[model samples]
Structure formats: structure tokens, C-alpha cells
Target: MTAPARTSGPVEASPGRLFRHRDFRLLWTGHTVSAVGSNMTAVALPLVAVAVLDATTFQVAVLTAAAWLPWLFAGLPVGAWVDRVRRRPVMIAADLVAAALFASVPAAALLGLLTVGHLLVVALGAGLARVFFETADQVYLPTLLRPEQVPEANARLHATQTASYLVGPGLAGLIAQLVGAVTAVALDALTFLLSALCLRRISAVEARPHRGAGTTSLRREVAAGLRFVVRDPYLRVLTVFGAASNIGLTGYQAVLVVFLVRSAELPAGLVGLLIGLASLGGVVGAALAARLARRLGTARTLLFAGALTGPPALLIPLAGAGARTAWLVLGGMLVSLGVAIGNVVKGSFRQTYTPHRLLGRVTVSMHLLNYGTIPLAALLAGALGAAWGPHGAIRAMTAWLALTPLILLAGPLRRRRDLPTAPS
Candidate 1:
């Protein structure tokens, strides 16, 4: 089920010159714009649930679960489908669908029809669209640039995306503070439309999937992807590590907004400010990732980055009023730094390492486990918060996150300097 590599240009793109690559620019621009919007929703959506709907701790956590639950169910099939179609179209269509879904929230609010149930439905629908969009987005990158250019391109994307994390939350909080959470959500919807327009202008053409007489059936294609990931030691280990880490990451995150607003007594504006400023670490990570990988090797980079992510998460729960908030900011910054570095390295590695045809399926296959745990973790965190209080839940989740890096040591990554370029 592996598809051959396709590129828009014959020559390898020079490092840092992708800005001159028209299609890549368009792709990057669209993705960056949408990322900002998504980050905004990260702040705005929960605020809507908490402020407008007066959702309880468990309910807010459920809202988080609803947004990610689609990955558990729709991921594998959507991956297979993306492999069988033009990825750009899938991406464009996903943006449009998400735009409409998010837009519905504010509309409902205006009519006094908004409910936690309504938010849950919107989250689920938008999550489904994200499943499609992300799968297609991962597969589509290789078609625009050469293998050698992937790390650089990924670095650029990660940098901008991280920048959005820095910008979006603060802006979302300000908008939430000034106008309302619903208005911020409405603005997020418009960003999707803008992303779709940028994507529409890309000129790179994807080769249609060949349907030979012996072409694998859909079920077989899906199975083939699963087999490829399970049998490959590298993919297997990475998938295991990802799934393990996400449980801890999303668990803490599922309860963080509630903890910050309710227990810490931070205003929505200050919470967004704290989060956005802390996300500056991600920008640093994205900037340094390529240089670190070049000097330290990708495998070592992963190990080092993993270290940065885990332990400092403990500081997050130390946060409280006034000057003590610096603990959360510092802790979050360090953790984000690690996560960003890992994302750049892993994203480039996966894009180059996997066969083009299996890219979608394989990407989703890994994500299936990586993200599938999110809802469960959210529920668990919600329950924990209900039982121990938000601060206690934060302590429990961060402790789990701190231990997850050990999972990587069990894999062959410990022995290798660089990840293999392709399947051996």
C-alpha cells in the first residue's frame, strides 16, 4: 500500500529557501493561519464552557474529551481514505467543515440555544474533521519538497505553529475578556476559511492512486498499514512511547484550565497570558531542533527533548496567586520546549521514513493509539479532579507524565544515533 514519492520540483530545495517555493509557502501559510485559530479555540472553547455554560470540572473535561474522541473511532478509516484520494482536497474540505462547526457555537450562543451538549456535538464533529485534515496534511508534505528538505520544512512549520501557540492564547484570552469567548470562537471559524483559500491556490499536483487489478482491498489496505507499524521496531517503539506519553500529557491538560481558573483563581485573561508566554519555549525548541539534531543526531535529540518535557511538568501544579504563577510559566515553558523539539524531529522522521502511499495510514495508525488515549485520560483526570481537587489531579497527572520518558529507554532508540532513513 506504499505509494511512490512525488515532488513538485526536480531539484532539492536549499535550506531556508522554502519561502521561495510557492506551493510550500501557500501550504505553510494556510497551516499557520489555521494553527493560530486552533490555539485560540484551545483557550476560548473551554472558557465558553466554563463561563457561558457554567460547566462543572467533570463537564469541562468532557468537553476536552469530545474534541479528541473522534480519533479513536474515525482515525484508521480516514487514513485509508486519504491514501486513496488527493490529499489537498481532503485538507481543504476538512478546513471548511471545521469552520462551519466552530461557527455554529457562537450562533447557538447568540440565540441562547447553547448548551454543554451543543458544545460536545460541535467538538465531536470538528474533531472528526481534524482527523481527516491532519492525516492528509502529513501525507501531502512530501509531494511538495525533497527528502533532504523535510527537516528544514518541518522546522519552519513547527516554528510558525509554535509562534501561533505563543500568540493565539493571549489574543483569545483578551478577546474573551473584552468581547466574549463566543466572539473568539467566531474569529477562529474565519481563520479556517482563510486557510482553505490559501490551500486552494497551491499548484502542486498529486498523482492519482493507481487501482490495479491486484490493488489491495480497503480492509486489506487498512490491515497492511497496521501490520507495517506493528512489525517495524522503530515505528512500534515510537507509537508505544507516543501513546504512553499522551495519556499523561492530555490527562493533566484535561484538567488544567479548571485548575488554573478555579483553584488558582486566575482570571481568564491572566490564564491566557501565562499560557501564551510560556509557549515561547516551543518557539525556542523549534528554532534549536534542527541544529541539535544536526549536532547530536536525531535519536539523541529525541532523548534530550523527552527529558525536557517530562520532569518540569511537576512545577505546573505549584502555581497559585501573584508571583507564584511564575512556577507554572517556567514549568510549562520547559515542557513545551521539549514537546516542540520532539514534534519537529518526529514529524520530519515520519514523513521521510514511511513510504508515501502508506504515509496517511501509517501516520493515523500511530496517531490512533497516540490520540485514542486522550478521551480516556480526560475522563480519568476529570474523575480525579472531582475526587482529589484540581490541584491534586494536576499532581497525579504530572507525576505520571514525568515517568513516561522511561518508556523510550525500552526501545532501540537508545542504541541508535540517528533513526533509519527507510525500512531496512
Candidate 2:
């Protein structure tokens, strides 16, 4: 549980020098392409369900649920497997498999064979690939940079993802509007191909072959990951806080488009524009995250970011039916900023604190908690919106947000200032 040793002096990274590391640059490029593609599908998949297939509230919920199901089902086994193999190959293979899966959509559409079932399959496959890619990236990142460079490396990664949100969804909106949702998905598939190419170019020291009698059985490996997290008071508190926040946010996301279309009475094009504008705040937040972490210390910065992000749900419901749309959009932007900042702090700390060998399991375990509740939240949000209307549902979600931070405040988070510096 002890952190690695550090030098006596403050850790420093050269200005923009992290990018000068060739492997990191390649990894960044690959992820950037994949991120844009992922964002496109995030927008495109729902549109296909709603627009083309004319899916109902519950059906749309199913699409969202399918996207997260892999984390629940495949997280632990995949994490164990990643630890036993070369992470780069896992990442590359994931990209290739994902590309093939995504490409099937446009092909099926062209053949007039597309259906809700086909869409569900694509969601499942893409989610599985995501689990692998993310697990590998978490395990592989420390190998590509020095310990001192982790915060900066993570910041840049966040920035790329945020930039994709800012650009990709808007672009997907336009493409979806012009050509169709399936074709827009083709663009996402191409990004995966690009990611695979980038990953293929990365050279690193692979995990050494397991020579001793492997004592880490799957169940034991999973339990160890769980034990490591539960034993660390900081991680334990953060996990609980994360689970609560995700529940609220996922619930809100499940019903967001419904609110925009039904209550706000906005057109699809206008909705896309509003959502894209809101994501600009994420870009700004990512840019600021490293500086904020350095200034506020990691734990305090994370607590502040979490607290700032959650209450914005109230604004969505409070913007009266008669209020200007601009006000609601501005509030959304602020929420994105807060969430982006929180993610940067948490990701950096997790990467820095966890040992490389355990990274995959720990990362997957964390994700399993963070994302496994999406189905429940999505179902609740959809049903509540249907039964009570979008405004009332949003109000209920705001209540959940209001209560989440209390979980963090009551735990070790209240007194924690910074992640422990590595021992010298």
C-alpha cells in the first residue's frame, strides 16, 4: 500500500516535453482518433434508435444499458487477462475488432438489414472493446513516461477527449443530419482503424512471461483488486463518491435528449448545437486541470471539483419552461467543466498511486463500480420521465445530486489534502 519513492526536490516536467516522448505521442494520437469516433457513436447510436427505428423510452434506455453491460460482465476477467499479456497487443486487437464491429452497421444499413437487434450487438461489441482499450491504457501509460510526467500525461489525455466531445458530437450531428446516422457511424469505424495503426507503431517492454506457478486465480485476482481498493481509505471513499455521482449523472444523461425535445421543445439540430456548446467547457476544464491540481493539491482539487459538478443538475429543472434556452445551455457548460476537472484529478491520482502490475485489475474494478449502475440509472430516468414528465424527473435527479457530496464529506475525503508523495 506504500507509494513508490520520490526524489527530495519537487517533481517537475519540462514545458511541453511529455509530448516529445515518442511512445506517448503515438498513444495520444491513437486515442485522440478513437475518442472522436467514440463521441460520434455516442450521439449517432441514440439518434438511430429514436429517428430511424422509432424506439420508445424504454427501448432507448436499453441502448444505453447495452453500452455499459460489458463493464459488468467482462471487467474482471479481461483485467486478469490483460495482466498476463502484452497490453499493446490487447489495445491494438481491440481497435481492430471494434473497427470491424462498427463497420457492420453501415453495411447492414446499406443492405436494408439493419434492426434494433443489430444496433444492440454493435453496442455490446463496442463496449467490450472499450473495456479492453481502457484497461490496457491504464496499465500501459506509466511504462511510456516517467512517474513525474503522469499528471501532465493524464491532463493531455483528458484534453484530447474533451476536445473530441467539443468537436466530434457537433460534427456527428451535422453528418447525421445530412447523410444519416449509420453513415456517421462509418466515420467512427474509420477512427478505430486509425487507432490500431497508431497502436501498432508503439514499442514497449511487454509484461514478462509468467514463470512461477501462477497463484493469482481469476477469483483471487478479482478479490485482490477489490481488497486493495477497500483497504485504502482514500480509494474507498472516492469509489463511493464516484458511484453516487455516476448514478445521478447517468440518470440525467439518460433523459437529457428527452428533456431537450419534449420540455425545451428544441429541434434535433438545435439540440445538437446546444450540447456541442456545452462541451466547450470540458475543453477549458481539461486545460486547467493540471494547474489546479498543482495549486490546490490533488485531493482537495478533486473534492472541490466533485462538489462543484453535481449541484448543476438543479439548474436543468429550475430553468422554467418559459426561461431563455441560453441560460440552461450555460448551466450545462459549467457542469461539463466541473466533471472534466474532477476526472483529471482522479485519473492522475489513480495512475500515480497504483503499481503497474495491478493497474489493469484496479482500473477495471473502479470502472465496474463507476459504470455498472448505468443500466439501473438509465431505467429509472426513463421510467420517471415517462411517469412524471421530464421536468419532474429532472427535479428528482437534482435531489440525488444534492445528496451525493454528503457521502464524500462523511468519509476520509474530508481530511485528505494531497496524494502521498512517492518515497525517496
Candidate 3:
């Protein structure tokens, strides 16, 4: 399943080259639009909590927590379920479900009925939907392209997502400024619908899962995914690293709007614009990942990328009035850049290394560790923000980031030049 010879190149060149494949085009388009919408809410939802509901710092943190809390409860089971089903329909259904949930926000807002409770419910429902879509997506992408195309495909996808991070927030701010945050959230609903439509158009017929009649109990199936990860040194280490990294990353981000707006007293538009500009680093890192991997070797590149992700946080907590705001931008950009490269490498590795039938479960199992800490971190950040102030909370979270990369060095990665393409 190597890519065609002519198609081999760095992923930064992928956007122009990969378009020749029809299914990849659909997958790309669907994810691109969807990413823009998702990032819009990344800015809009918090603004709604801040401006529309006038929510407390703790309450805003709860909104962030609710969105991710589902993973802790449902992630393992959902991975097993997805592995037994056709991934595309599952994704489509998740999209439709998410659309309806997000759409409820604007509808409620327009009717003069919006509340923090409503926003929390929407976040919970949307988070559940995300569990399904993301699990299916990791398995689905490979079916549409050769193994070699995966890195490039991932790069293209990550680049677009980063671009959306670039554009979506600014647009959200403009919309939030002109109309309201509720209205900008409605745009997220629309993006889900469009994503569903595009996914339906992808013509590839996916192979059905082999877990047919008389298969093991769902619990065992779930455990199998967990077992595989726990037994594999690489997966075991990566999972732990992901959990630790997320605690820091999500903690800072959960209350970032509050920090930038209430503490620093930046306007909503400026807040959105600043985040958008800083996220440009992700786009840059995604483009550079392939060449960097080639140059530094995968294993070492990961170490370097891992290093970049953390130390920059010291800059973020130092952000201050006027020109000093540059600290947030510089720190955030480096974090984004480091994270982007690390993700491209990690994503491609997971997809290529795992067995096809186990892909969904394995992907989700890993994400369970990666995303599982998010809710707790959000709550912790909120509490810290409420008690110690946003600056104190951010400094603590960023400091944690500076330390998490040491987890990678503890793994076998330090001894290798590159991560092996297939498990031994």
C-alpha cells in the first residue's frame, strides 16, 4: 500500500499533489470546512460564556470540562463499537448529531432562552459526537490513500486545520462583534452539515469490520484495544506522555479567553485576532514536519519537537500591557509549532503501524489517554484562575508543559533514529 512513485514527496507539497485522488479530495474538503467551524467555536463558545451568559470563571471552566468529560466515560466503549461498524456512516451520524446540538444554541439564544445550562448540555453532546468522528476518521483516512500518502495527507489536513485556526477565530470575532457569539456558534452547526454532505460524497467503499456474529463481548473488545496499547512499549509511553501533555495544554487553553479578556482587558476582537495570528505557527510547523523528519530523523525530530512544545510556555505567563502582549504570541506560536510537528509524526506512525481491524480502537484508546485529562485540567485551571488569578494559573500550566517532554526520553525513542514503520 505504498503511494504511487510519482506522488512521493514532502507533505507540504501534498495539497497540490494529493488532489489527483478523488476520495482524498472529498476527505480533505470535508475536514477543511469542518476545522474552520470547529476553531470558530473555540473562540465563540467561550465568548458566549463570557459575554452572553456572563458566566463565572468556574462556570466557564465547567463548559470546557463538560465538552471533554465524555471521553473518560465513553471513549473505550465507543472505540469498540466503531471497530465493529462501518466508520463512514458513524462519522456522518456524528456530524449530523453535532450539527443539531450546536444549532440548538443559536435557536435558544434567539428565543431569549439561552443559559449556561444549555451551553453545557451542547458541549457535552458535541463532545460525545467528537469521540465517534475522530475515532472513525483515523481509520477512514488510510482506506482512502496508500500508506506512503498518509504523512502527506495528515500534513495537508493539519495545515488546513491550522489555517482554519488562522481564519475562523478572526471571522468569529467579527461575527461576534457584529451580531453575537450565539450567531457565530450557529456557523459551527452549518459547518457540520456541510462536512456531513462532503463525507457522503466520498466514493470509496470501505471494507466492513471483521468483528461479526459471535465476536467477543464488547467489554473484551474494548479491553483488547487497551491491552495492545499497554503491552506495546511505544504506545504505553506515548499514551502517558499524551496525558501529561494534555493536562498542561488544555489547562492553559480552557481559561485562555478569560486571561486575555478579563485580566489583560483585551477586546473580544483582539483576543480572537491574537489567537488566530499565533496559530499561524501550526501551519508553518505542519509544512516543515516532513522535511524536518527527513533531516533530523523521526525519533530525534520528535525529541526536538517535544522540546519546542514546552519551554516556550515561560513566555506566555509574562504577557502584559501593550507591546508586552507579544509574549503570548511568541510563546503560543512555538507551542503550536512544536505540537503540530509532533502530531503529524505521531498520527502517521499510529495509522501505519497498527493493524487495520484494530485501528479504530487503538486510535481511540490512545486518545483516551491524550484527551482524558482535558476535563480535569479545565476544572483545575478554572479553580486556579478563580483563586490565584489567570496569570498564576497560566504560569503553573506552562511550567507543566516544560516538564512533560521528559516523558518521551524515558521511552525507547531515545535509542532509535526513527520510529519503526511497523511494530516488531
CA deviation > 4 Å runs, candidate 2: 1-12, 207-215, 318-323, 422-424
TM-scores, all candidates, are: 0.95, 0.93, 0.95
Please give the CA lDDT of all the candidate structures: 0.88, 0.78, 0.87
Where is model 1 poorest over a 10-residue stretch in terms of lDDT? 4-13
Instruction: Look at candidate 1 and tell me the lDDT of residue 350.
Output: 86
Q: Write the residue-wise lDDT of candidate 1 on 1-424 in tens digits.
A: 8753332211134655778889999999998999999999988999999988899999988988999999999999888888888889999999999999999998998898999999899889999999999999898888888777788898889999999988999999999999999999999999999999999999888888656312668778788789999998878988888887788888888888888898888889988888898888999999889888877878888899989889999898888889999998899899999999999988888888898878888999999999999999999999999999988888998999998888888887888777777787
Residue 339 displacement in candidate 2 (angstroms): 1.4
State which candidate has the highest lDDT: 1
lDDT for each residue of candidate 3 in 1-424, tens digit (9 for 90 to 100): 6542121123344556688988888888989989999889988999999998888888888899999998999998899888888889999999999999999998998899999999999999999999999998998898888877888899888888888988999888888888888888999999999999999998889987774612889888788889989988887888888899999988988888898889989888888888888788899998888889877777788888889898887788888769988988899899989989988888887887788778878988998988999999999999999999888888899999899999999998898777876666
lDDT of 2 by residue, 1-424 (tens): 7555431211447746887888888899998999989888887887787778877766676777788889899998888777777779888999999999989998998898989889989998888988998998888887778888877788888999988887777777788778887877898999999999998888766656355314668788777787888777667777887878877777777776667766777666666666677677788888888788777777677777877677765776655344466656676677778888888877877777776667777888888888888767877887887888766777787679767877777765566566655312
* Comparing 2 and 3 on lDDT, the stronger one: 3
Error of 2 at 333 (Å): 1.8
Model 1 RMSD in Å is 3.6
Clash number for candidate 2: 2
- Alpha-carbon deviation at 137 in model 3, angstroms: 0.4
